[model samples]
Target chain A: MKILVDTLGADKGYEEIVKGALKALENHNNLYLTFIGNEEEIKKLVKNNTDKINYIDTNEYIKNDEEPALAIRRNKKSSLHLGLKALNEKEYDGLISCGSTGALLAGATLITKRLQNISRAALTIVFPTEKNPCVLLDAGANMDCPPELLVQFALMGSVYSKGVLNTNNPKVGLLSVGTEEGKGDKLRKDTYELLKNSDLNFQGNVEARDLLSGNSDVIITDGFSGNVLLKSTEGTAITIMGRLKKGILGSFKAKIGALLLKDVLKDVKNMLDYNEYGAAPLLGVKKAVFKAHGSSNARAIETGIDAMVKFVENDIINKIEKELAKKEIEE
Target chain B: MKILVDTLGADKGYEEIVKGALKALENHNNLYLTFIGNEEEIKKLVKNNTDKINYIDTNEYIKNDEEPALAIRRNKKSSLHLGLKALNEKEYDGLISCGSTGALLAGATLITKRLQNISRAALTIVFPTEKNPCVLLDAGANMDCPPELLVQFALMGSVYSKGVLNTNNPKVGLLSVGTEEGKGDKLRKDTYELLKNSDLNFQGNVEARDLLSGNSDVIITDGFSGNVLLKSTEGTAITIMGRLKKGILGSFKAKIGALLLKDVLKDVKNMLDYNEYGAAPLLGVKKAVFKAHGSSNARAIETGIDAMVKFVENDIINKIEKELAKKEIEE
Candidate 1:
């Protein structure tokens, strides 16, 4: 499989992105990468030139402050726009970027276009759970969503879980304030009614507290609440872990204790750190694309590349298109 | 001061409730308590014939499954209903109940009535931060709120932080997906405009990740999102702490390390425990009312009573009424 890698917008600079792409290439001999950025900078960092590696020059890039929809329309020569345009042209099987989320979503929808019969694209994250990682979608794609849009998110999320996460008969749950028949606000109640009658394995309303407990394989909500849930959980974990560290280092006995429990601490850290998943896929787009973290290091970028390759190999985008088309036909 | 206590709805039974009330009575010399529940059960538990502890007979109680509005209208003899009715009649300074949240909210709103100029009653929680406790409002009251209602929440939350939490010129922030001026859904954007034009100390949009950072003294949002945020943080904390404990006990080295850091762990646990604060106040109501956790023990119950006493002494309800009236006058 071939992938287009946008080597800009990351906090670690071009060196880390290049190194990560090279490392990923070393592991997957059948995979090919086309780097999108400054050609000279890419040449200076990458020592070896092989048929597997390619480069596309684009000095311009979209900034986080610019309006997403307008920037994608205006910045034709920018790396983000150009990289997505290349993928749209079928130059590569997938695309990955650590750029402005707004710009990426706009480019993915407006430039590359959304999948057939899909109303809107959703940004999905695989949150780690006690059993396995669950797919949570519309992470921040559409801030305000109607009931129909949320129904689409549930269908899309289920497809991603089955295709990428390798889950069979993935259970889809609507995120709400309660687990009863008629709970949550108007949007949720309406969405619940729609989902209950759908073909997916619809588990009734799942409370936010149960979102992280592995109650369902796919949890769907609007972008605003989903984003808040994602960020709140992350912030709480960071704060608590920080407190735990400070507590351990506050005394002499605790300091010694910490040294002895280093392995266990590492294990817990790995369980909480979301970067282990590499990137969050922006699903419902016409092609396979991912948004890596802004502060992604070499390892995280390489992990993202591996995931993108798998997304292409698994034919997730096409699978989503087929499922959505089937629904359209039934409708 | 006089306080009305509902002796039903707790998971632990009448004996625990009686013990908790007695414990609270021991702490306050000039305080009187009116217990509302089964007359026989109360007589069996309370051996004291003191005039300070009084009882009212009520055979019925609201269940969690009953519709809130219907239950409040129908279940007149319920402990919750009778307690609220007693408080509404000016028989007590304040009220405390660990009953169905829906029933409590309905009883408080319908029987006690809302404070003048207040749009709706809000459930307020004081979340402990590194610096101090920050007040979060509309926790689960109104699932869907208009922009004007959110502005009221900000006003009420600020009053709560000032009167109860003792913060002067408290910073009120609108919770949203981003910190930008025009971020979040239509509700947040419109609320931002209303807050900016209002007299309150309005801080622009605050991300959910910053909710626990003590960045703002009061965080305001619609009940649906607020409930999700509250529950998500709680679930994440519980999951992480559980992982930490499991990891520690899984190995001998870590077990010894944990033994040495027992004091530190205790400190961290205390910092994260919501029970330390005892109860969350149901603000915007005419009376000082609180809803304790259903699983609350004797210590938690006592703490709730102490808080009720403070609420009456500070005249928080009256203070909120005055502030809200002043805002209306200015408008």
Candidate 2:
């Protein structure tokens, strides 16, 4: 499960991340795809079946309008800093990068860092919601923090919904503007009294109009209100699907009722596809960086390398570093 | 343009608010409506047409899960405090309410107050988007503030995008978590250095995924990040149109292409209807309260009395007290 791919920072470059890493090496036969950047455009998009992909050659990329801390101090051999120096030499258990979300949070916090009692870190994004697909988090990874880093982003988004959305305990919420206990500000009434005296599953204050009534499975906030509630729900679901395709193709009997729901509107646009929940977890990184969405394509970078191979088979950063070292040895 | 309206805080009471004010006085005519409450249940739902419409009894009726500041002090003869005491007796020209958005912001700040150099008051909404319909403001109103009340909520959201979405000058922004000029907190870096030396039209910051793009026609924030970017864009457009209606009714050639796009999925559920832009406009009140969505129905209380007869025949509270007294004499 060795994943490192940046393959020239997204918007589908280098032949759709070398044909989505040869369709995830035909479903992970000991996966190894490294391909960072321009080694003859990823050797003609991984041609001549290049022994299950590899090539960190690099050629500066991070340009989604530069200045992410001055392009990680003027491009230290860029390709998103050589894919955050191969996940800071864990060689690659995880680290994908569709690219330039401010140069993957300034080259993954200057090549892997922030872990012990993580003060600021976040990029969550879950979204399949109707019940489970809620987790929003630092959708804007720290612009300014401390409400005890949103109570450690609600215990790192309920330790990624009880270790990778399996969710048995989860429940937490603090995306504010009232659920009371003297509602919001002073950093959400001091992170709602440190997440209602910490333990987790704290569901108290959540109202941004009842976040799609599947309510709390870890919503958290700050990274500037989870990057404006993950870009105002990705620009109001692309302006309510661009006014539902101009109000159903602006009449002709709503374009023959949108051509009889055009193949069930492309399977309801692949279940409100944010590339069907691909990659976002930047969390309090030690290994998994994730990022994707520099206009991710090829099925959102094969759903960001199957969400970095389900965070390297759900080690989930050593269970969020043993739940922040057992909440720092019980404070 | 009279207005008043509580008709005993709706839950389909006062017979669907007198059948949505006799279907908005049969398409408005410089109307007058009033209707406070229990005048024998709004004269048995406007029977024998009591000369068009107007009532005022009010033996009270608040409940809708009470606690909106103790249901406006245990219902002072309710009807949301006699329809905000007839918009503080200027003989109404504004005052709607479907009921309890914390009892209409604690009865419009303890009965129609803050409009002189308006210190606190917000609730805006108007979203709609796909390039038109923008305005979001403190959509839940004050859940803790200061960055000079979000730089007087970006000059009352640039005088509500030039007086109710007419946008002559608009472009205000500042929702933050990037679009830099010192990315957020400390109230978005002190409201982006007083909206980069004010005189409005700032446009410096805007991320909650570009709040339903049209980019900015007044965005602002803080009402706990504008109620978590208005309830995570109403829970990601009802969780991406309920997984695009169960992946377009999962089955049989997508059920014959979703019955030929049933009028383009009701034009994508009326372009993601947030009650098709009904209430919300309590902006630094002195009149015109608005609110609406308390399960509104009756065509969202006749589009919240046509947004209070276009904010009472468009003199929007003397043009927001002369452009907030000309931005407090140009600060």
By DockQ, who's the top model here?
Answer: 1
Rate residue A28 of model 1 by lDDT: 83
For candidate 1 chain A, which ten residues in a row score worst on lDDT? A44-53
Q: Could you tell me which 10 consecutive residues in candidate 2 chain B have the lowest summed lDDT?
A: B41-50
lDDT of 1 by residue, B13-43 (tens): 7667777877889898889988888878787
Clashes of 2: 10
Residue-wise C-alpha lDDT for candidate 1, range A1-331, written one tens digit per residue: 7889898887878788888888888878688889999888888877664778888898788888888889988999989988998897755788888888999999999888887667788999888887778999889989889998988888888988888889999999999998888889999999999998999999999987877689799999999999999999988888888888998878899888888778877877888777778889998887888998888888888888887887888888788878888998899
Docking class of 2: acceptable
Please give, for residues B240-277, the per-residue lDDT of candidate 2 as tens digits.
77776776667665556556656666766776686767
lDDT of 2 at B39: 74
Per-residue CA lDDT of model 2 for A131-180, tens digit only, reads: 67778787776766778888887888887777777888988877676676
Candidate 1, superposed: residue stretches over 4 Å from native: A47-49, B39-49
Clash number for each model: 0, 10
| Least well predicted 10-residue stretch by lDDT in candidate 1 chain B | B41-50
TM-score, per-candidate, Cα-based: 0.96, 0.36
Q: How much lDDT does each candidate structure score? A: 0.86, 0.74
DockQ of 2: 0.29
Quote the TM-score that chain A achieves in each candidate.
0.95, 0.35
**TM-score of decoy 2:** 0.36
